[model samples]
Target chain A: MTATLTQLIPLTPPANPQLQDIRTQAAAYLQEETIPTNKNEEWRFTNLAPLLAQTFAAPNQQLPPVNINGLVIPEAPDSRLVFVNGIYAAEYSSIANLPAGVFVGNLAAATDAGLTVTNYLGKQPGGEEVFTAINTAGINDAAVVWLTKDSSYESPIQLLFIATVDDAAVAIQPRTLIVMEAGSSATLVQEYLHTSIPNHPYFSNSVTEIWLGDTAMLNHTRIQDEDITAIHIGKTAVSQSQHSSYTGNSIDLGSKLSRHNWEIFQIGAQTETNLNGLAMVNGEQESDTHSVIALTKPHGVTNQLHKCIVDDRAHAIFNGKVFVPQAAQQTNAGQLNRNLLLSPTARIDTKPQLEITADNVKCSHGATVSQLEDDEIFYLQSRGLDVETAKILLINAFAVEIIDRIPVASVREKLAVAVKAFKAS
Target chain B: MINPNSPVILSIENLTANVDDTQILNGLNLEIKAGEIHAIMGPNGSGKSTLSKVLAGHPAYTVTGGKVTYKGENLFDLEPQDRARSGVFLAFQYPLEIPGVSNLDFLRVAYNSRQKHLGLEELDVFDFDELVQAKLDIVKMNPAFLSRSVNEGFSGGEKKRNEILQMAILQPSLAILDETDSGLDIDALKIVANGVNQLSNKDNSMLVITHYQRLLDYIIPDFVHVMANGQILTSGGKELALELEAKGYDWVTEPQPVG
Candidate 1:
């Protein structure tokens, strides 16, 4: 049946008893929350008509083996989880020997002895969001990760979600849940790739929920490079305990339409958080980023930098919010959003907001949108570089502010190449 | 116009130009020949810098009248990049700071562009690295500077030296040093003078624009010209730079007696 977020999603009984109430709550929340329109302050610049107008059905198609041939990650040599059409494909997957307390496998093939996930699964900061609620209501299989106390993984854990060509106008809801116990550390790399059937208009409504215990840390990298025929809306929710730290680098380079939401909560004191993101779009593509950092405890610290490069007739939007309440005195927070418009027709809208009630805290937020300077162009041209090559060099520099932060050498190199190719196209 | 059969590298006659509705260069005339070094001395607002920019085809400076012949071809006809490829180089008074592009990579691209213009094969990264390191000695620059962004976070003196290093690599036939000694200390000035001296050969020429005579003392100009409003007020030998340095620009600003 053709459906929207307003309609009921049919699902079998929950195999894990813990998810039953959460699913019911999500269904009720969907009924109460209306889909955000452009009239809403948060969605002022981003029109969701292209996404809402599409008639979507269930994603049940199996994927072919074409995803594994050219896709590789040298940084993540330990394990690989390939999800095709939101289902785990074991034939194209591998797992190296893991530590005693570490578990790496499919989420649907539930192993009960691992760390507890029921406490964090489906628990997102914006559980009432229209798209997030839809993901909770429709998701059955997820890529889950768990590490026990005092355990650390040297190599990265890679999760690749390849959205296949769906016969129906379908929305693929792929969920990711990672839980780390006290004193544990791990690196997770999740890449969203789509092999689109032309003119299909597939939608990937994905969500990832992460929980870190006291003193735990995680370096998470998410790269979304969907095909132009696809609509990608993903949300990453992170909850950190006392003394825990989180570093994330989000790189968005593709998709006809994309909206990524990041909600971070510093529930415990003395936590540190860093978020770096880059979005490069061209043609008629629209990429929007919305982030929120809520520090409720004292002595929390955060550093965030988000940049965007809009070309052709594409539009990019950024909305960042940082909240430091009275209890979070002595918090230090900073946020900046920089945008580069490559053409006269390209557009960018940015809003960086801060709500701080703590008198002793220091917080700053700003946004800048500018075109390529003629002086800079002439400078390179004077050195014998043609105008186009000079623009590419400047564009690459604009993105390196975020791409250089990726610790994985292979991922960084691939992104550099992708940035160059994106400028040419 | 200077004779095309001779070795004149640049000839400017009756040049009139402006930037933003303000006339800077009016009826400026000069002639430069190969194997000759010309030093232009002027006060503040005397069109010294404008002359260099107009010669290099800066877009901001509009030439209303007059003409410039570079290597016997119309200089205004070529784009700034083409002018660079044809061996007309300008060391900016304040070089631009380009972040995220390594200095070595930028120099290599620049060098290869000139080589390609001459129909020579371009060098690869390894070969270019070796060549760039050898040229760094001219500026007394450290190899570590190559890994940094082009002129980004560099000291004022370092930026000037990088400019000279580029001049060494490009080996342009007509090089204009515009206020290259503006923000340098004694040691940096000596290094810059030494680099310019090394690159100055009989086959090439130079135009040094400066307000002080300290730079000329080291580089030793073949001819010195005093510029007042828009044109060269007086022309003489190297001793003229020492005369102006001692007497100040007041002598040049005043109307001179009829010859």
Candidate 2:
């Protein structure tokens, strides 16, 4: 049996036609784009050795059976898509009462049917991002939802992605495209969870691209609370046209090494965008978030606020940048990052950058990192609470501003429960 | 029928303190009985404020010599929270503005700390709210202020009122009002003094440290001591305050009688 298993393993690279072709293409891409080093500006302060050292493997073709009961959203909308190991699970999905001309299906099926895949696929710029390139190349299947022009949907479409394998290293590349045409409005929720047992190691690489036409509105929410042993890299790119509005609230709770990237481009005038996020990390976990908002046209407005609470030797990093072009007169942008360190060893590094070439624009950016105030703690302790209780109350109050901004009540409640439990423990 | 031989509630003996190596309290000595209101009238740099802070365990002040005893216990051995829980209250001259801590929550914690120190059952949220609301009337404070952050965006009078409100809820045995009347308008001064007077009983005593004698008019003290050069120059009845207000500290501060 040992000899047979050894013979089954390829001596060099697989000789199968499809496998060989894929390896050759991947090798060529890897050669063209060398791994980023410390000298690279975008990769500064972020060491990628943990990600680069891992052996990459494709997602399993036959996904293991998963229970959808634990993944249900109370009072869920008519349309929902569930994906496991980058493959769509139709038995766990629902798309009832979808409006006419709305398209919701798998990316592979949409491409095979000759749907408009080229218009949105790979449309987002992944400049100097090797992980994004790898995700783009490894894209096997994805969930794509497109709304027709002048159509509004009352219920939000929910997408659930779960990773449930233990120790057997796997990579999940979930690509999503949400297009809202003129006069259309909708909400999209993208949730990621890990059902794997404790101490299991996995990787999740996901990219979502969103496009909004004239006068369209979209509310996007992304929640990541996976097992602490998993590594995650997620990217969200949005493009807004004239008079369009796009808002996003992202909450990241669990992961051993997690980094989220958000990039928004305002291509037309009078576009509005609001982005908010909260990251809670504890127990040696590290979470990093990077965001860039670019105003390419005049009369664009953008606001962003990101808060982080790091405890128990955990570290959090936030880098936010806003750029206003020369033609983007009257552009208004504001960004702030506030962090609280609970333990003495917990660390937070925040940098807010603003680059404006327009003279008539209003732009401001600020970042602050500090421990809880002693006076505040004493004030609480003086009331009857112990020192630990006082610290928890003040820390919770610090995070309340960001948590209250979550639009989804159920998700907000879930996040609150996680925070309370974390504090208790 | 007051006990003339009763044990002292608080006694400071030759207490010398320094801030960043600059000596502020140079061998200061003071004492308070269980039911008496003692007013310390002093000029600038007389260490009146330092006395209040050293008792409250403010981190900035260092006691180089001497000791402070509260209810027969050494005050220096206790942390600030412990001292506070043991019924030692300091009404700050300038209360800090904690932006996110609610006023009601602040009072509740203070009240609970005392209860826990006394080994009593703690009050629930509903009961705590009711208790705080009842005490708010002592300071003539608005109920809306309870929802706001502690001392945040408050006027000078409002901050002082909030301090007294905390005192009423905590019900400390020995309260130190550190220049609490400095920034108050006439109306606010009356309100604060009245609140302090209401909270004082036979079981609780107060040490009023002030530069002017205006506050003593409302909360009339049983004994008045003139503090000069960090030591009590003289101690007398309430009439001593009238003398200080009329002639100012410069007059009595020069070669006066000690008794």
Winning model by DockQ: 1
TM-score of each: 0.93, 0.84
The C-alpha stretches of model 2 lying farther than 4 A from their native spots are A1-31, A65-81, A89-118, A145-158, A187-189, A282-285, A310-314, A341-348, A417-425, B1-8, B11-29, B59-78, B109-127, B228-231, B250-259
Q: Write the per-residue lDDT of candidate 1 for residues A142-188, one digit (tens) a residue.
A: 78888889899888888899877746777778889888889999988
Q: Where does the lowest 10-residue lDDT sum fall in candidate 1 chain A? A: A1-10
DockQ of each: 0.66, 0.31
Cα lDDT of model 2 by residue, A128-232, tens digit: 366665665555557888878988877767889888875667777777888788888888778988778787777788889898999999988888887897888
Runs in model 1 deviating more than 4 A are A1-3, A6-18, A112-115, B1-6, B21-23, B246-254, B257-259
lDDT of 1: 0.86
Per residue, candidate 2 scores C-alpha lDDT tens digits across B101-188 of 6788777767777888899888988999988878888989999999998889999999999999988888888899999999899999
lDDT of 1 by residue, B68-177 (tens): 99899999998888889889999989999988888999999888988998898899999999999899999999999999999999999999999999999899999999
